[model samples]
Target: MPQAEVDTPLDNAAVEARRAAARAVQTAFRNSGVHAMLEVATTRAAPAVSVTIPLGGTSGSPFLGGTGLPLPDGAGPLQQLLEHHDIHAQVTVIELGPDPALLVALTTGDDALRLAALVIERRSDAHDAALRLSGVFADLGITEDHIYVADGAVQVGDINVQDAITLYDVLTGQRNDAAELDLGDRWDPRTWRDVEKLAELMGPVVSKAAGEPLDCIPHPACRTCISSRPHRITLGSASPQQVLLLADAISSANSSSTSGVSPPTG
Candidate 1:
């Protein structure tokens, strides 16, 4: 026996139901809060929603100064400085934003050459400093086992205060003939920035080995480190000072959403 076949089309009700579901999802997504910070530790591209911020989007927020925060010396002159430094320095480009704001991240040579540091742009100073410190163990030379340069997607693995302790132990070792040394110190903006903890720790020892003072300021290489420090603080909530300032900026940027905020009256 042959069965009768039935054809069915969605009624207006079904279409409306589907539309309602989609709208609900869209509304929920729009209202979601995303931290405006990008984590470079991972090799993934930042989300389009965060990147497509308008000139007035993330800029006009009181946090970014109603049109983006000013670099210490501003962008124009800084560009000239960075370009000049790049000529003889180990500086390179890292990330560039839609508005063409350059995100220059740098590392020294010793710090740069490692596969872990390969994830982003590194300044030669770091590598040099790391090597200069490593020079104390120059007898070891660059071994395939100790120092490795990695390519493709590589994870930094677990990094913590304990890691610094391990390096610290190596630095304090009496042998000093060891193949690798870990020199990391405090996580403070007062001296080095994000990637510099180990460098900072190892820096002083290397400086002393090189007969230079830890405070002995080298000729300035890149202002990129200093420029990013504030941004780091702003994002990490590491420093209360930056948090207050950024919170104020966020408040101002989103003043419309903050009904309880009292506007300054002239």
Candidate 2:
């Protein structure tokens, strides 16, 4: 008698591979120290699939959400899943430090004075730091932007002592305006297309109070402070990075809602 038909070895391998990749992504997330959430989806008609991973939380300054993890460990497996299914996947990330707008305000012209005030407001303990910063800024007869322009090497007083260190740390925190991506090693034509589509969608909706629009979502509470463009997540409108930032804001807001954390004052 003819042997009963069974699943092909190739099919079995593919299933096993998908499972392994998913497991790897989960493991990576756990080890990455980033508080993030993941979602998986498969589109109709094309049978294409995708994964959405949002990373970050509000551990640093409020009103400012930092750029999330650099290249998360889950990226490799996430990329594999994208290629295996010949579909799209987005790793939405949350910045873990200060908000983009705060950084902008501090690094720009007089915005640093406003940010310094806000910093003191948020963290009353920072008042002394603010005072010291003011003295240094006043003595140098320069704006925070000038200090940043000088690469934090400008001397205000006692060039080799504690004053410089304090100024450096405070200024350095605000001067950071770098962008981070998680495209991984397996991106192909499809991934690039997806990313470009996301960028187009996100450009108009995201908002930044000071500099260019942040490529991420803003927290609902942050709406009061940050000036964004309506905060809508129109598919293909926002890049994966923007969505990730939005996700971080959403998560932080949710957590705050539950934890009784106070919202930003100004």
Tell me, by TM-score, which candidate is best. 2
Deviation (Å) of 165 in candidate 2? 44
Positional deviation of 137 in candidate 1, in angstroms?
A: 18
Tens digits of per-residue lDDT for model 1, 1-266: 99886444445664354344334323322222111221121112221111111222333122122122323233354345444444211222233454423232322222212212221122122222223222322322212112111221111112233332333333344233222423233233343333344444444543333233332111111355534322111011112222233224323423422454433311
Alpha-carbon TM-score of each model against the true structure: 0.17, 0.19
Local distance difference test values of all predictions, in order: 0.28, 0.29
Q: What root-mean-square deviation over C-alphas does model 1 reach?
A: 24.5
Candidate 1: segments with Cα more than 4 A from true spot = 1-165, 172-206, 209-211, 215-266
Give the per-residue Cα lDDT of candidate 2 at 40.
Answer: 22
Query: Which residues of candidate 2, in runs, are more than 4 Å off?
Result: 1-12, 36-50, 59-266
Residue-wise C-alpha lDDT for candidate 2, range 1-266, written one tens digit per residue: 89985433334544454444444443333322222232222222211122233333332212122222223443454334333443343332334344211111011112222322333333322223223333434443323311110111111122211222222223223121211322231112223333333344333332321123543221111234324211121122223333344334434433454566633312
Candidate number achieving the greatest lDDT relative to the actual structure: 2
